[model samples]
Target: MTIHRAHIAGAALASALSMTSSANAQALEYQNTSGGSVTVYGQLNFGYLNFDDGESTTDEIVDNDNSPSRVGMALVQPFGDNQLRFRFETALGLRSSSGISQTEVPDGIDWDRTNIRHFDFAWANPNYGTISLGQGSMATDGVTGADDSGTDVISNVSVSDIAGSFAFRDSTGALTGVELSDAFSTFDGGRRGRIRWDSPEVANFTFSVAHGTEILDEDADTDYTDLAVRYGNDFGDFNVNAALGARRIQPSGSDDEDYVIGSVAVHHAPTGLSFAVAAGSEDGGGDYYYAKLGYARDFFAVGTTAFSIDYYEGDDINGAGTSSDSVGFSVVQSLDSANSEIFATYREYSYSDGTATSYQDANATMIGARWKF
Candidate 1:
């Protein structure tokens, strides 16, 4: 199958390129300085492209290859007599991320900087709440959906878009696309500048709400809104977290616009087990769900191998008219956090009533070093 070959190819590619080493960067030498401060951190991942879903997300490479990886910096400074604060994070490596198209997918895209990997500023102690601004993911973005589907736009679903997906379609089948939740992608406020609030939690439960105004070119558009509630706790050997989230777009009009997502996760670490369930509504009018179960233990008590499994499905697309499911597993090994091995994942999808079907899986083996200051 196409999906199977893609996985194997990507794996072979990753295996060949996985031979990597990076000199350790000195740690952030904090002098306990008084005024405002700046901090930075990022990672670079280069590997073979062995994925067989017959759907190469970015580019269809023949075998093992080298590629650009993630790199970013965070900056913070105080202004306005300590009343105002600004922070911005940007990147050149995100082209390989899940939210947007990378040069990796065959004959893929080329993006320029200032695409705003992320930017936000906060003025604290405001009347309604902390006034903030940015094009980053809003409060409900991760709370209600699959937050880190490989931390890449091509692999994850965007919670803000009415379309709610990054996977794209080619003449033969479906291929993954950039996060697509970006400012220019679609739907007002789908991904835009906004401010939000945090109602101090009571009885261990918290509340948050945020709204954005889509910048349709320099003209701007109607307000986009997101609202949600969250709850979590750990008692004895049991731990739990749950979130109920939703988003409504172009509040000014009620045409074909709407999306919803819900999620719950639990862990029983004593037994090395965990589970998660997430569901969403993208139908402009329908619904869907994704789930996972995982277990971990030292393979033969050597601390060299670990494993997990994940399953996913989406239905009643935010208005796209499609539905599908995916299941995956991963193996990992570590000699301390700096040096580790990761082998992951398989996902397959069946379209509406067998009208269409596509499969995708990833096999990545990497050995790298990381040092933080």
Candidate 2:
């Protein structure tokens, strides 16, 4: 297995693209005067999502709700036992949403495009490990996650993906008048502008650390530090992966806060059975719990067919005594021949306030297809 000490999604897409020698989707590779080469690769994925606010529902196309749709390039140069690498990547919002709008596009311009997602440099030595800098994931990013469920491409209990576009109905069946806030979970902390380091694995254990600032406002008087430890091993037919991480944020004009998160997942390859659990808490007044169980089988000629159920509960978000509960189920079918997948999911979300009064609830259903090149 190839070890990816960089961005998780990047590594996955790169691996998928590397297997295809198709003339239509070929990666541009160049050999430099030095012992080095550069490769350009990317993937595009989109889905149609329908969200219900109890009284009404709307459907729209969205991008990266599951597997992100992006394009990127990488440069690698070998120096004896060590290597130097650089990567540049950006995402496509695809659909017009609050986060990205097409209305402002200049006439004659088909697309205005989004900003770069990943721009980083790294140095790696098999014996000494790797160090990276720039806009990318922190060491603790995804460290609180342990989902072996194939449905992750469609649903993983992260409510924000679909909930953002719809409103939630209060207990009395009244609209909150605002878009439902994204689901809360410890499975957050995506990419950021940071410096990170990964230590070589020893006895199936590896360590990582990072310091970074929020992506949008780097100059904000806020700074964050993240640290994590990871474990992976195979015992007979059982494969296990576990991670623990902690983060401290010193926010501008606010009291400092810290958080701890951990997760473990186990899978039986021969039987196609898997399970995972995760929990986390913040120093102030917030906590979350998540669990998922699933199975995968080669029921189709194309690839494996998988299904899973996931649950999440979060409390006192940002010290507001706001709580959320979400339950989701999904089915995913992979088409190996085309390097793509078809998935469908159903989710129910509930929210409450500090007084234990029901705040809102909503439902979402999505059907989508994704392809990686």
Best by lDDT: 2
For model 1, how does the per-residue alpha-carbon lDDT over 209-242 read when each residue is reduced to its tens digit?
Answer: 7887754245555676777777888878867788
**lDDT minimum window of 10 residues, candidate 1:** 179-188
Residue ranges of candidate 2 with Cα displaced over 4 Å: 1-35, 96-115, 177-183, 215-219, 318-320
- Candidate 1 lDDT (Cα, 0 to 1): 0.45
Top TM-score model: 2
Give one digit per residue, the lDDT tens place, for model 2 in 1-373.
1112123554454466443222333344545566676566666566676677666666666664456666677878899999999998776545522232111222211233235677889999998799999988888888767778787877664555644545566667766644544446564556778999999999999999999886655466778888999999999999999999988888989988888988898999998999988888888668888899999999989999999998888888634767778888889999988878888888887776666445656777777777765
After best superposition, candidate 2 residue 122: deviation in angstroms? 0.3
TM-scores for candidates 1 onward, in order: 0.64, 0.84
